[model samples]
Structures are given as C-alpha cells and as structure tokens.
Target chain A: MRARFNSLPPRLKRGLTVFFVLCFAITLADLVVHKHGDHWWNFFGFHSLYGFVACVILVLVAAWMRKPLMRDEDHYD
Target chain B: MINAPFLILFAGAAISWFFPAALRKPVLLIFPVVGLLNLIALDPSQSWTVSLFDVELTLFALDRLSFIFGVLFHIAAIIGLVFAWHVEDRPQHLASLLYPGSALGVVFAGDFLTMFVFWECLALSSVFFITARGTERASRAAIRYLVIQVVSGVLLLTGALFLFHDSGSVAIRALSLDEPAGLFFLLAFGIKAAFPMLHNWLTDAYPEATASGTVFLSAFTTKVAVYALARSFAGLDMLIYIGAVMACFPIFYAVIENDLRRVLGYSMINQIGFMVCGIGIGSELAINGAVAHAFNDVIFKGLLMMSMGAVLFRTGEMRGSELGGLARSMPRTTGLCIVGAASISAFPLFSGFVSKSMVMSALLIEHHEWVWLAMLFASAGVFHHAGIKIPYFAFFAHDSGKRPREAPAHMLIAMSIAAALCIGIGCYPWLLYDNLPFAVDYRPFDIPHVVEQTQLLFFSAMAFIWLQLNGLYPPELKSTNLDSEWLYRRAWPSLYGRLCRIAGWGQARFYEAVGSLTNALAPPLRKQAFLLLMPWSVREMLMILMILLAAILFLLFLHRPL
Candidate 1:
C-alpha cells in the first residue's frame, strides 16, 4: 500500500479522466434532475463553474497575501 | 437534587483531581453518560431558582434550545475524554471535565448571574488545557487567551449590570440593540464568537495546545458563545454582515496557514459564522438551522481535531509542510479525517449540508442576496482550505519519508464515535431536526439542493487538483502567517518597546537637567523631588473599570447613594 501510494503521479491520467467524466456527468444531471435555483440557477453547470472559479480565486488571493504576511517560523520569538 | 447534569461534571472534575489515577478514565467516561441520562430525565417545566438579595437567579432552566446544547456538550465531553484517555496529566483531565461543565452551565443558565459565573469558568478551566503542554509558546498563548477571555467576561458582567439597572431584572431575555449597554452584550458575545477582528485568539491558541487538549479547546468555548448570541441577540440586522465577514475572512487565512490545526481553527470561525448569520436571520427555520449546525459542528470538528490529534500524538508534527503520506501508516485516521473534511465541506450527504443549506436558504428568504453570495464564496473557499488542503497535505501529499504507528484504541474509538455522528446526522437529519428548537421545514435532500451541493464540492475538488498538478497551489512551508493578533503580539509590543526607549531617554534628560539645577541651587532636591509623574499601567485602567463597576453594583444592589 505504501509503495502504491508513493507512485502517485503516474495515475494522474486515469484520475483526470474520471474527474472530467464526473464533471460532465454532474452537469448533465442538473439538466435532467428536478431542482430549485436560488440565483442564476438556469445555466447548466453554473454551480460547477462558480465553485471552481471561487476556489481558484481564493487560493490565488491567499498566495498573494502570503508575501507580506508570511514570516520566519520563530518570527515572534 | 444538585443541578444534576452539569454539576455532575464539576463533581467529576473534583473527583478526578483528588481521587486515584486508575479510576480516573472510568469516572470521566461514566460522568458524561450519566449526565446525558440525567439531562434526558429532567422535566423541562422545572426551574431551579434562588433569591439572592432581591435578585432572582435561575440557576438552571431547561428549554428546547438549552436542551439540545446540553445534549451536545455531553456528547462532546464524552468524545473528548475518550480521545484524551491516554493523558495521565491531572490538570488536563480536570480541565476537560470543568470546561464542558461550564459550557453546560452556560447553556442551562436562565439569568445573567448564573451565566456569568460559568462563562468565566469556561475560560478559567480551559486555560489549563493549553498550559498542560508546558512550552513557552503555549504558556504565552495561554496568558493571551486568558486575558481576552477575561475581558469578554468583564464585558458580559458590565452588560448584565446595565441590563439589571434598566429592566430591574437579570433574566436572560431578548435584548433590543438600542437598550442601554446592549452593545456590551454584543461585544461580549462577539468576542467569544470570534467576530472578525476579535477572532485571532482562537486561530492563535488552539494550534499551540497539546494534541488532546486541542479537541477540548475546539468543542466548548465558541459554541457556548453561539448559543448565547442566539439566545440574546437573535434577529439583529447588523449580525448578518458580521456573520458574513466572519464566514468569509477566515477561509483566506486557512488557505495560507501552515499549521493544519490552525487551519481547522480558522474554519471553526467560518462554521460559527453560519450559525451567527442564521441567528441574524431570526426566522424559525433559520434558528433551527443555526442550532443544528452548532450541534453537528461539535462532532465533525472534534472528529477532524481528533484525527490531527492522533497524527500529532504519533508523529509529533502538525504543520502541513512537515507531514505527508500519513494515510499509509494511519489509514483509519486518514479515512476518518476525510469524513470530517467532507462533512465540513457540506457534500450532499454530510452534516454541514443539511444545516448550511438551511442558512443559505434563510438568507434568500430574508432577501440578503449579497450576503448569500459571500456565503457561497465562503463555502467554496472552506472546501479549498479545510476540505482539501488538510487531508491532502497531512496525509497524501508527497511522502515525507516518515511513518508512525496507528493511534491508540481509545483515540480511534473517540474519532469513530464522532465520525459516526457526522454521517448519522447527515443521513438521518430528522434525528437532529426533531430535537431542534423550532420545526425544521427545510429539506436538504431535495434533488436541487443535493445536485447543486454536489456540483459545488466536485468542482472545488477539480480546481484543487488542477492547481496541484500545475504547481499553482501554494506550497505549505514552515512559516507563521500574521493575523489580527499580530497587533498585540508583534506590532504593539515593538511599538511599545520603542516608545519605552524614547521615554527612558526623555526621563534621563529630565533628571540630568534637574541635577544641574539642583547642584547650582538646592542640592537636597535632586533625588527626592525628581518626579511625581508615574508611567501608565494597564492595571490602572482595569482599576478604573472596576471602580466604575463597583459604583454601579452599589447603586444596583445597595439602593443607597452617597
């Protein structure tokens, strides 16, 4: 199990395939499934796009913040 | 007989402190169970009251809201004690009992005086958990935590006095924001709830406590604040914005935080934000959502903390940079942590979904469209940081070439119990809904809600994996990221140090000039008449506040004016 865990990158292709497949599947499900929308719920995959974009922006903004905020481990000491 | 449910815990604390070591764990375990049973058997119509010098104090009152919170504290205490089963440390053990005992006290308190005593106890007892670590950082953090907590308590006291003066009663009731000293109540509860600027102590201190100690730290303090806010200031429009900021700001900090436990701490604030927002919404369904979320958060958050605690227990490392591939060694802990992550992330069938969706829906019901959007962004951001970063870096990121044993049986048992509650609550929310303070009309498992929540979570994962593959995600490193506490810890101290140096220089010049004048005229006056001016002390400010409070107390109680 440890050896298998170590070889993480080689399985990226399969992982990506499954990921895209699931993403496409979820988008389709939204069209077929009966659902309620709060705002802009008409667009298929609106939530997917929102979640992805929101996450990306969150990480980028935080990474930018680290420049001034990050300090040495013992900075306070 | 003697305030059965909560005081039993206080008794257990005393027993554990004075009794033999071998009996401690069994005693601790039995107390929460017995407490829960006692709570269940208690008649809600019964009220414990005492007349104290013309003031009526309801020592213990059972209502639907307090009932659920009492149940939660017991469950949290049990899980927390089991997690700390290996801890032979007396202070930590005693504090574990006393801390939750106080939380239950706060929950059941029907008057200000009863609430204040236990409110302060919540702070006083919990500090032992941090001090139990016996490190310089923990010691400093403990004192800072205690000071902030004490200030919050004092604010509560001040608010209660003014409340009693204004209404001629000290009962816990819905206070109008315009009421005299109502702002004090908000500030007091806000500080405990970690409202925006007042939040850093939680993120600062929890990560520094010992492993099991962090679990207890996570459980009680903030949730008690949430309960207090819900009880007192529900429906305040201003809280909507405050809750939104509380929900949104912490995720960014969580994103960059190296300490995994501190990341959880930030997200803890984020979770409480939802509860606060629901309280602001003040609708029946919204209050139910807030209360249920508080219930679920204790279990799921404790589960996450327990997993991290187990890792810290075994490997002695908590930073994401210093941890990796722990799943290979402690597979069960990894699996349980992911359960916690998923629950917090609000996937379709997790505890957070049932409760968080209700708050979001309440936002729309109240026409808080922009706050709703901010909350949605927070959902995504929390998933990015706590949901993904915690498990990925701590368990499955590039193996750091370190392996450690699985957590002890007791710890795993504790984690499993909490994890089970997370899934159980998600799967059978009616088990939670039936006990809520209001009738929960919200349906979390509807096709639209489930589909939408799944889309949000999956795409968040899609972004995380993409960022990781392309090296766009920020790498965890051994560094401290500054937050609000930096004002007191870094900026204020250094600023004060420079000010002290300048003051010292001024004082020296003053003395030298005075010496020269004295030598020329009166030699005897140089040392004795040097200065009547004294440097400022924080104690003096506290003294003034105390004197004011004493005067108010005299006016309120004595009814005699000088």
Candidate 2:
C-alpha cells in the first residue's frame, strides 16, 4: 500500500493539497450565501478558521501539558 | 407483563449459564432478538407495573423516549454479542446480557425506585467486563470503576429517598433545582455522564477491559446516564457550561495519550458533552437532538471500540506508540475504523454530522453564543484527536512491522452493520429523526450546514497533516497523562501516607512523654510505692492488732467514765 501510494504520479501525490484547496474554495463560496440561522454563520469561513485555530491550539496546549501531565506508564504504580 | 424485555434478557442470562458451549453464542444472540421482539409486541397503552410492599413500581413504560433508547440498547446488544462470538467465556457472556438488560431496565423505568434498582444492576453487571481481562491492571481498574458506579448508584438512591420524602411520590419526573434532592440527582447523573472531575473512572477502566468487553462497556453506562438526565433534569442551565468543559478539555489529553483506546475513552466524554448541552437547552428540537446523538454515539462508538478490540485481539497491543501500518495486514479493520472515525468527526454525510449539528444549532437557537462557540471548538478538537490522531497513528504512520490477521468474520459483520448504520443514518436521517421523542423539523444536510461542517473537518485534517509533515505533532509515547484520577490514585494516597506518618510521629512522642513523666516521678515515689506494692495480708494483720488494742483501751476508758 505504501509503495502504491508512493508510486502515484505527482498530480495524485498532491491529492491532499487539492482537498485543502477545495475546502477553502467551499468556505469562500459559503461566505456569499446567507445562512438561515446564527449571525455567526454569516462570517466568511468562520468554521474553517475555527477548526484550524482550535486544532493548532489543541496541539500546542497538549505539548505544554506533557511537561506536567506526562509520566512513566507506571507512575501511579 | 409476562414478557418484559428486561426480564427476557435476565432470563436469557440465567438460562445461558446452563447451556453447553455450542449453544452459548446462539443463546446470546437469540436473547436480544427475542427481547427486542417482545419489546416491539408490548402494548404502549398500558404499562407493566407491580406493587411491592404497597410501593408502586413501573417495570415497563413504553413511551416514545424509552422506546427509542430501548431499541438502541437491544441493537447494541446484538452487535456486541456478534462481536464477542469468538469468546468462550461464560461470565462475560452473562454480563453482556445482564448489562444491556439493566440498561433497558433504566430506560423503561417509570419511577425513581425502579430506576435505582436497575441502576445498581447496571453497575454490578458491567464491572465484570473490566475484571474479565484478568490482569492486575484490569482488576484495579475494575475496582475503581465499580467504586465510582456504586457511588453514583448511592447518590441516585439518596436523591430518590429525599424526593419521595418531600413529594410523597416516587414518580420519575422533571425536578426543579430549588430542592436539595434535585442536586443529589444531578450529581448522581453527572458522575455517570463523566462530568469533568467525576470522569476518571471511565478513562481508567474502559481501556483495561477485555477486548470485546470494552465494546460492551462503551455502549450502555454513560448513555443510560444521558437518558436519566434527559428524562428528569432537562433544561437545567448548569449543564450547559459543564457540557462545554467536558467537550473541550479531553482533546488535550487525547492528543498526548499513547493508548488508543484510552483516547477513545476521552473522546466518548467529549461526544457526550454535546448531548448534554442539548439536554440543557430543553427545547423540543434540542431534546430530540440529544436523544438522536445518544443513539448515534452508541453505534459509532461501539464500532470504534470493536475496531480497536479487533486490533488488540490480533496484536495484544493497545498503545499507539506500539502500533503502526497494520493496514497492510488488517485492511478491513482499517477501513471500518476510518468509517467510524469519519462519523465521529462529523464529516459531512456521516452519523456525527447529522446528530451533532442539532446540538450546535440548538445552542444558537437558545442564544447561547459562548456555549455554541465552545462546542464549535470542541468539534474541531474532536476531529483532531478521534478523527485524525486515532486512524493516523494506528494504521498509517511509520511501519512497525507487525503483521496480524484480519478480525474474525463475526467481528467484521458486526462492524459492517455499525458502519452501514452510520452512513445510512447520515444519508437518510429521517429514519432516525422520525423515531425521536419530539417532532424534529431540523434538516442536517442544508447546504450551509454541510459546507460549514465539511470545511471544519477538512481544515482540521489539513492541520494534522501539516503538523505531521513538520514533525511538530507530539509523537505517541509509552506514558500516562495525568487526569482527574490523580487526586484519588496518586495525590489522595500520598496525602494519606503523609498524615499516617505524622500521626505515627505524634504517637511516638506521646508515649515518650508519658514514659518521661513516669521516670521523673519514680525516685520520689519509689520508697512509698514499694510499701504500697507490698503484699497486703501481713500489713492487714498488723493493722488489725493495733486497731484491736486501741479499741480495747477506748472501751476501758469509757467503762471507767461510766
């Protein structure tokens, strides 16, 4: 499976990038469309930005938490 | 009345004990189906109630809410039974039946007394799954799990007693927080719901259960708590913030945790938070959303647990640090796991998207802007840990060169059913929504909702990939991340040890002071103390003689005076 994935053409290798581009484009299109509910939905790409920011914060905070929270598997023992 | 679903399951559990090995699996599978059939056949117009010692108990209340939960538990039982078909353990099988039976009992209960009875049964039956692993860690974890569950049960009973005392009725109904009894009930439900600090038992125990045991453990206990909360405490405003904290905090732990199953345990709490928030809103749409989400969670989370169980069964490993690239060997499990992951991540056209959107939309409808934002953040965080982290490290990261066979046929069939349900519900949500307790007018697949959800999930995936490629993502390591359990597991024990040491020191000093006082008084009192310590017989004889002479002299003097 790894070989197959690696053997793919450059265009295919960029599949992840293409997916991200498409997501961003959808977000852009959603900006012009008026949503039925919450005024927050009217903001351009609110959910996309929220997702990215939340994930980044999660990773950074987890890394910080490791200093105090992480211990040997047998720490309790 | 003769064939209450819970009774059938209990009877099945009892009879299965006498069944031979060949008949056990069939018995296990047939019991749930028969019970489900019995449940379906029951007349909703009349409840099965009994009077015990003049106290009324409702055994089967087939209302819409209970009906939905009842069907979900029965279906979960069937899936769990299939997943464990390869096992020959009798106790585990019994527990699988009894656990679901007790959960159904809680669901169908019409009064607090009946709920309490089933609540305790659920705790007792479910603990077996954790202990069935038969490891020292599993035993310890099971004990902790049982303690927490029993505590919750006690809280429920105590609250019920108070409620009965105050109202002279035991009917399970919505409670106002002005009464102290309501507080106790809230706490009891909160503990099982994995409310923040009370949550450690779940993360501590579920991961340690037997491979299939964890699957069953994942489905019933917390969802039953959700049912209790929704039934009795809906619209309690405090649950909104509590649910927000629950949804957000676990992701940090999930990010760094090495145990894949433990991460799932944390994610379970996060998902439950959404349901809880909806219950707090207490609107028709919100309550329906909460119920639907609970239904969806059981299926999808069970699928996730089954996939992890299959991995554990094949490799005897639970840590992400110890597993990678198993897709080469267990491609089917891999594919199914990703499906579970997508459903949980709320990717468009998955079970999660259909249900979770309801809670988010409900929060907005209730004008809970801040709470809605927190849930939105949680959605992304869930995607980070459960969606990206779980599948990424377990199946696709650097190859660890472990070649395990695919999961057994029964396991695959079970997982396929769950995965199909997830997609089926996502694509055609009306099938689930039509059965909700309230009329649900919410449509999940509106263009804006889909676009927003898809953007959020896809962008989260992008972040994961970006971090992974940059070597910035925290590598899964063989370590334990401290959680609320630290207070009881580490801090409380250490504190007790310190207090013991201090008491020992004080006791020693106390003895030493007493001894010193005795020593200081010894010289002055020694001589007199020796006489005092002398045998009393001789001293009494001499004293008697002296007394007799004095008496005689006194008598003589008195006679002369006369």
Candidate 3:
C-alpha cells in the first residue's frame, strides 16, 4: 500500500489526535501523581516516545538488513 | 483426565484412517467434543500412577496448570476439526487428532517417562500436517521439521535419563540448575519454545504446511513446550534475558519477511517471549501471567493462522507480496482477521491486553526493569508487524487484483468461534484467572495500565503510518533471508560441494600424471601393474583359488596336527 501525500488520512488524523491528547494528559498527571518511584522511565511520554522511535528504527534497520540477508528465492539451488 | 482425552483422540485417529473420506468427517468432528466433555468431567486435583520396572510413572494427572491446557487443546482441536470439515485429506485429519492428543498427554504427564513417550509422539504425529501439503517444498520442510522436533525429543529423553540417574526419581517438579538434568531440560524446552536461534524450524516449516494443517500446527507444539518449562524451569533467572532476546530479535526479521505465515511464526516467538520472561520472574502473579498468556496465545494465534489458512485455501497464495484486496470478496474472513490482529496487538478490550499486561506488571514488581523495557519494545513492534502489517497487506493494501471467493462456511464458523473467545476473554478475564495455579491479585484495566498501553500501541501505529507514507516501510518481496539455518542449509552444503569438486579434479589430474610417468619411466613396470590390476576371468579365478588351496595345504602339512 503505497500512498505519498502531504496530509494524513482522516482516520489517522483522529487517531493521532487521540494519541497526542493522551500523551499530554499523562504528562500532566505524572507531574502531580506520585508513582511508585520518581525515575526517568516513570516519566510520562517515555513509553510513547520509545515505542514510536524504536519501531521507526526497527523498520529502517530491518529494511537495510535486507541488503545483506536477502538472496534469490532459489538460493538453495 | 489425560488418559480419557488423549485416548479418545488416539483411538479416533486410528479409526479415522480406516473410514472413507466421507465418513471420516463425522468421526473427526465428534471425538474432540467427546474428549472435551470428558475433560470437563475430570477432577482438577487428580493423579494416576503405574509401576514400570520397580519405578512409578504418572500417566494421567491434572493440576491447575495442566487442566487449563487440557481444556484449551480440546477447544483448539474442535475449532481445527471444524475448520477442516471440507478437507478430504485423511492423513491430515489423523495428524490433527493425534497432535493435540499428544499435547494433552504432555500437559498431564506427572513423570518424565510418560512425558517423553508423548513428547516423541508429538513430533511424530505433527509431521504429517506439514507433509499433507504434498508440495516439494512441503515434503522437504516436513523432513526438516521432523528432524528439529525429534532433536527436541532426544534432548528431552536425555534429560529424563540424567534426572533418573541423579535423583533415582523422575517426578515432574520445579528444578534448579544445580541438578544435572536442569540445563538439558532447559535447552530441550528452549528449542521447542522457539528460543532465538533454534527457531528457524518454526518459520521454515509452518508456512509450508497445508492450509488448514497450519492451524493445527500452530495450536499445539510450542505451547506444550511452554507448559513443560513453566512446570520445570519457572524462576530460572536466565530465561528473563533469554526471553527478552526472544522478544526483541524477531521484530527485525518479521518486518522485512515476506511470507505472512512466517511473520506470524516470528510473532508467536515474540509472544512466547513474554510468557518465558514472566515465568522467569516466578512470582504467583507472574506465573499466572505466563500461563494466562499461553492460554490466550493459543486462541488468538490460532485465530490468525486460521484466517491466513483460509486465505491460502481460497486464493492459493500466502505471501504478502501476492495478496491484497481480499476484503472485496472475503469480508467475514477479513473482519475475523482484524479481530485476531487487535487481540494479538493487545488492544484494551482484546484477549492479549488482559494477559500480556500481567506479565508487564510482574516485570515491574520483580524489578526486571530492562526486561520490562524490552517487552514494551516488543509489544510496539508486534503491533507494527503482526497487528497492522498482516491485515493491512492482506486485505487493505495495493490490490494484487486477486478476487477469490470467500472462505467456506466451516472456516467462517471456526474463525467466528475464535473471535468470540477473544472478546469473551478480554471482557471477563476472571473466568481464566479463577483457574490459575495461583490466586490472582492483579488488575489489568487500571487507568495507568490501559492509558500507557494505548499510548504505546497508538504511537506505534502512528510510526507505521508515517513509514508507509514516506515510502520507508519495507515492501514485500519474494526472497530468502539468512537465518541460523543458513549455516547448514546453505553455507556448509555449498562448502562441502566445492571441496568435493576440487578433490575430484585433483585426483583425476594425479591419476593422469601417474599413468604417463609409469609409461615413460618403465614400460615393464607399467605392464606388470596392468597384469596385476586387470579384471580376472573365470579360468584365472579358478587358478587363483587352486593356488590358494595348495598354499593352505602346504601350511597345514608343515604344522601337522599341532
């Protein structure tokens, strides 16, 4: 599914809005709410950022990995 | 519990082979239901022991752990049997019966000896599922699958024998690494659990299985291994790190992997990683999480495999590169697949959310901070690859223009049953929690838990959407990628063939040079060599025999009667 556009689809727009709103809400709550401990990971938005960035890197690295790993379908022959 | 359910399956399997294809369907469909009823009738706290050579072996038993698996396997069997109602392949029907039977046998086995017998039976019975595809690839893959499975069995037997020698007993119980057999048991269970490098057999073979056969294949083998580990290897610290690695590594391979079923295989390993890590934590809640995830995984992963299998059956295509726009025809299958994807992705109200969150919470309680992070990464990656990529490419992507008919009625019934369970488990996890080996004290729907999990998944999906729009997402293509099997399946074999060719050339040249040198240096020597090396005629053979006889007689005469 290849689609190159400058704008997000309406479904994606709505999803992103929910995601951003959640991130903001969690961030505000984390400042006042006493979690089990105050730590870097306990900070809100870490899960979101890590999840997003890790997945992006996962895709890029995996795509680049194909250069070294990929071979002909009949490579065994 | 074990004998009744497994006996029902085994007897039905044997009898099924004799039935004509038309008659086999009823037998295939009825026996698993009977077995389920029988399973439900049994006492959860029960054991049956027998004497063999002055030793006690438990052939049938049930604890909370094995009892749940017994029920799960029966349900999986029923769903699988119903899915294959239209399949006239009797051997697959037989394998389908015995494979789940063997899994239940393993689950209820209270001693090593009984477990080993059914462990090997699991290997032997499941191979036919792959072979039922009857393609060249399927045949070769079946052999490879059999070899790996038998290797796991051999390891199991080796560990059992060692346990017997060290302890003079073979009871299944929690073990520590100090025991002689502990590491062997870990490696054995590790292999079947699809521990990182030992995992290629799963990805290599499952995709090659027959359409409905893969559904049965997905439900039983690795989950039984998980049960074995939870019984024996729970609280082993190394599994935490091993499980973390298992969780993370498959995401890389799965992203660029073209085969849709193979992607799910990787996803299966990823999901198993969560269970393994939870088992390593070994608290009551953690163990509960591990076992619960195992239960949920069988249902959800089976659902996904059935959906893919249905697509394969309808269109004769499995690779993502070759499938798209299937929703136009198979709307029900598409919707069922989305439910599976959502469940596996751990959407808030899906089966995965209820169980998988338990593992994450357990990780925090046990202070496995790094492993917790790894699992979260795996969770996001799973959403990207399995949850989104699977349905997106299979049903919603660039049209490959293949407009095949919808899945048959039986297959839809199977998918709908699984989808309903996914929803049922998600909504009412207490039905599962009350049956756990330990008391359940965790809440999965807490505000922080649900909110954080949703953030992780939604952001992960956002990343996926961004990648797709930017043309950075790896497009599906038909190609082989190097895995651990590359060493043997390709590299070593190629090296051996080259060495053989070189040695053959060198030997031919050496022979030619020797022949020329002999002719040039001494013609008489060459003639003598020819005469000695020439093929013998019948007269020459007789003459040689006579000479040998005369020499023996002379020697005997010289020695006399001494």
Candidate 4:
C-alpha cells in the first residue's frame, strides 16, 4: 500500500493516504476499547475495522466514477 | 354582495384575456378596488346567502373572521397587481385576476363543496404565474408546486365526501375536532398553509418564478389556508404542537439559505406558524390573533417579496451570494424592504408586534408554557433571519459592486401601499379586529406586552449583532439544504431509479426464459403435428372412411323397412 501510494501524484494521493490512515487508526482505537466482543484479536474483527475498509473501498469507487461523470460547477445553470 | 367581489375579479380576469396590454393593468387594478368597495360596503351586522347551482354561496357573512381575511385579500390583490404592473403578458394578468377571485370564493363560500371548488381553482390558477416566468427551472418547480397543491385539493375533496357522509350536510361552519375525516381535512389545509415540513414548495418555486410574478405568489395561497384552518380546526389540541413546530423549524434554514427569496419563503412558513398556533388555542383572542397575523403577514410578506422582486427585476440576481449593497442605488426599495423585514420580525410598533403577540398572549393565558417558549424562540429566530438577514444581505452585506438602478415608480408605489397597510393595521389594531368573526376584546399596546416584546426582539437583535462581529453565527452559504422536499427531490427519485433497474432486469430475464422455452417447444410441437398427418396414418384414415360407408348401408336398410 505504501509503495502504491508513493508512486502516485503527491498531493491528492497524500491527502487520501492521510485520510485512510486516520480512519484506520480511529477504527483500531475503537476496537481496542470494544475488544471485538470476545477475542484477543477482536480489534481486527470489529465492525469499525470493516467500516474503515469500506471507506477505502468507497474512495476508490468514487474516484473511478468521477472520471466519467464529474462535471464543471456551472454544468446546470 | 358576496358574489360581487368574485364577479368583479372574474370579469377582470376575463377582460385581461382579451384586452390589449394597455388596458389590462388598469382594468386589473380596478377589479380589486371594486372588491375593496364591495368589502367595505357589505353590512357587517347581516348574513346574506345566495344559491348558485343549488349550492348556497354565502356572499356577505360579515363575520369578524371573514371580514378581516376578505378585506386583507382585497388590499393584497390591489397591491400585488400594482406591483406587477410592468408585466406585459395577457395570460399572466388574466391568471392574477383568477387567483384572487378563487381565494375570495374560498373565503366567502358558505359550504364545504363550494370551498372545495374554489380551493381547486386556487391550485389551477396559480400555476400560470410560475409557468409565466418562462424559465426551465421555474416551469419544473411550478409543476411540482401544482401537484402538491392539487393533491391538497384532492385530499380536501375526499375529506368533504367523508364529511358529507358523516353529517349529511354541505353547509360550511366550524366542525367538531374528534373525527378522522375532519383531521384529514385539516392536514390538507395544513399542507397548503405550509405547516412545517410541508413548506418547501413555497420556497422552492416562489424564488424561481419571474420577478414580478412572485409578488402575487406570496400573498394568497398559504394565508387562505390559514383562513381555512382557523375556520375549521381551531382549538384542535394537536394543532398547538403542529403550529409550534411550524414556528420553530424554518428559521435556522432561513438563516443559512443563499437564495434570499427562498429565505423569505422559509420565513413565510415561520410566520404561518404563529397563526396556526393561535388557531389551535381557539380562544376568541387567539383566533382573532390568527386572523390579524394572517392579515398582517400577507401585506408585509407581499411587500418583502415586492422589494426583492424589485431587486431581481433590475439586477436579475435573486441569490444572496450574487447580490449585496443594493441600497446605494435602490434606496427606495431598500427602505421598503426594511419596513417589511421589521414588520415580519415583530419589531415593537410594527404589524407583527401588534398581531403575532396576540397568539403568544393566548398561549400564556392558556398556560402552554413550553409552547410559549418555543414560540418566543421562533419569534427571535424570525428576527434573526427574515428581519435582519433579508435587508442585511440585500442592502448592506459585502458589496458586490453592482449598481442597479432603483425599481420603477409603479413597483415602489405598490410596495409603499403594502408597507403603509402594515403600519396602518399595527397603529390601529381595531381596524382588523372589528371585522374578525368574533368580538374584538384584545388590545395590542399594553405597556407590559410592549416592553417584553421590545426586550425580547431587541436582545435577539443584539445577539445577532454580537454573533456577526464574532463570527459565531453561520454565514449564508451557497448550497441547497434538505427539507421535507428531500423525500420527493432525492429519496423518491433514487427509489424510483432502483425500482426501474430491478424491473428492467426482471423483464430481461423473463424474456430470456420465454425465448429459450419457445426454442425448446418448436421442434416437438411441429413433429407431433406432422406425425398425425404422415403417410403411416393413411390406413387409419381409410378405416374411418369404411366406418362411414357401413353407416350409410345401415341407413339404406332402415329406408327399405319404411
């Protein structure tokens, strides 16, 4: 993931990478408190961990969609 | 006497359709003046009813409530027509006539069915005003508005049917609050009156209309709904809650809205909230308060719309982000807009102060403590957004360096007339009160009431000032905020798209299955039919022919016996 990020355009990629790291850290902290309901590895199994993963997925999906349909601010009026 | 006002209005509308533009405005202006004369000339002490198509159309009831609303309607119509005098379209002028005529019909109708007809008329006529704006957005918004309004009419008709079933009479009068059907009718009125979440149509479409067109749009529909709600649903307990919520919810949104006209639209909803709560309390004072507030709101709100209409007319910009420091050039319009904003904010000695307080007092007397608090907060909210935001953004906010000229003389004259009415009614509350359906026992100028309102509003203004200086208040942003309209605007569209996609896939699969089935059945069906007619089956056919020959011989044997 670090290698993939370092190869991309710096500003936008840096912004997304920071966002992903913050989200991942928040999930890790939440799972530490929640303890994933029962297990020692529960932090990795928590819903927020999945949520962070979903955020990353959505970011990639959104980027893909934006290429085709993204528009100028004055598109409508 | 009752039909006189409507007849005048209808005649004006009919003439406008055929009359040249030179004659239309003057002719339209004359209709409302004649209506004003008819209204003033009506005998307040007597009730007169006329029958049309075997239906009793109460013409001049002169009940205090109808008198207040009717008189206000006449005045508003006159002011609105004059404000839009520069509009050259014949159909629009014709529509303007029909709109008010229908409102008068609703106001004066003696029966539910009569009211329903006028109710539907109001919906049908007002669409033209929006459509006349001639913008794609305006046309779309107008259609949405028409659908909501027409749906309200349908609900009203359905309610009327049930009401007739329940009571076996069509005579319109105050109704008992205990029935579901009556409640349905109230919801219908509530929707048109723009009760809270049902309000976005007013803001959405009114701003999108032609500059001159919106002036007429602001006055009639919701106020007429308030008149209906006050007539039928006064004192229904739930109305208090509904009305309280109506008063409170729109201010924050109005405060942040970029579209100045749309902000006024939100403020319109907020103002109606006061009247609705007053109706719910159902005291003579409270109902009077509602009637008075409706009367005041129509004038001042129309004036506000006119001022903004003036701005839009000259500069062609309606959004707050696109307009500022207009006061330097359009000083007259800026002054008039401030008068409107002051009246709306319930500034002490303003029309809002005189009328809106009666509802608040009714709450206090009824011991509705929390509702009263909600109302007071809403009152402050009104001041913060409409009273301040409107004039501030339009006249004095960050200057955009556009120096549009003053509005035309006719527009200023129309606005002045409305502004004068706002002050006239405030200074002499009895002018409105004496005509209410009930006795006028309430006075607006009690010292304690004045002081308290002054303190409340003045302090609220101070809060606004402090917030502005400290950057604590949310600045007006250029984005559309979601309202109840989100259900139709966003949610329903999404749900509809999803349903269409699912149906498309289902149809594709069904067709595919049918195609495969047809391919599978073709050979077998053909073979079976072919086998039945094959040469191998010729012997069976010959046997059948031999059987027929045997039957014929039996018949010949029977004939010999005969």
- How many backbone clashes does every candidate have? 0, 0, 0, 6
- Clashing pairs for model 1 are none
- For model 1, residues B1-562, the per-residue Cα lDDT tens digits are 5955778999888877767777888887888888999999999998888899999998899999999999999999999999999998788888988999999999999998789999999999999989988999999999999999999999999999998888889899998778876899999999999999999999888998999999999999999999999999889988888999999999998998899999999999999999999999999988998999999999999999999999999999999999998899989999999999999999877898999999998998888888988999999888888898999999998898889998999999999999898999899999999999987777788887788888888899989877876678999989999888889987887887776666667667866987888678765645555443656588987898899999678544433222
TM-score on 0 to 1 scale for chain A of candidate 2: 0.69
- CA lDDT, candidate 4, residue B329: 97
Model 4: CA > 4 A from native: A1-77, B1-3, B44-62, B514-562
B409 in model 3: Cα distance from truth in Å?
Answer: 1.3
Number of the candidate with higher TM-score, 2 or 4: 2
Error of 4 at B397 (Å): 1.8
The whole-model lDDT of each prediction reads: 0.89, 0.89, 0.87, 0.77
Error of 2 at A8 (Å): 11
lDDT of 2 by residue, B214-280 (tens): 9999999999999999999899898888889999998889999999999999999999999988998
Those runs of model 1 whose alpha carbons end farther than 4 Å from true positions after fitting are A1-12, A34-38, B509-562
Better of 2 and 3 by DockQ: 3
**Model 3 CA deviation exceeding 4 Å by range:** A1-3, A6-37, B1-3, B495-562
RMSD of each: 7.4, 10.6, 7.7, 16.8
For each prediction in turn, the share of the native Cα contacts (below 8 Å between chains A and B) that it retains comes to: 0.85, 0.76, 0.73, 0.00
TM-score of chain A of each: 0.75, 0.69, 0.57, 0.40
lDDT: the better of candidates 1 and 4: 1
Q: After TM-score superposition, what is the CA distance of residue B85 in candidate 4 from its true location, in Å?
A: 1.3
What CAPRI-style quality would you assign to candidate 4? incorrect
TM-score, chain B, each candidate: 0.91, 0.91, 0.89, 0.89
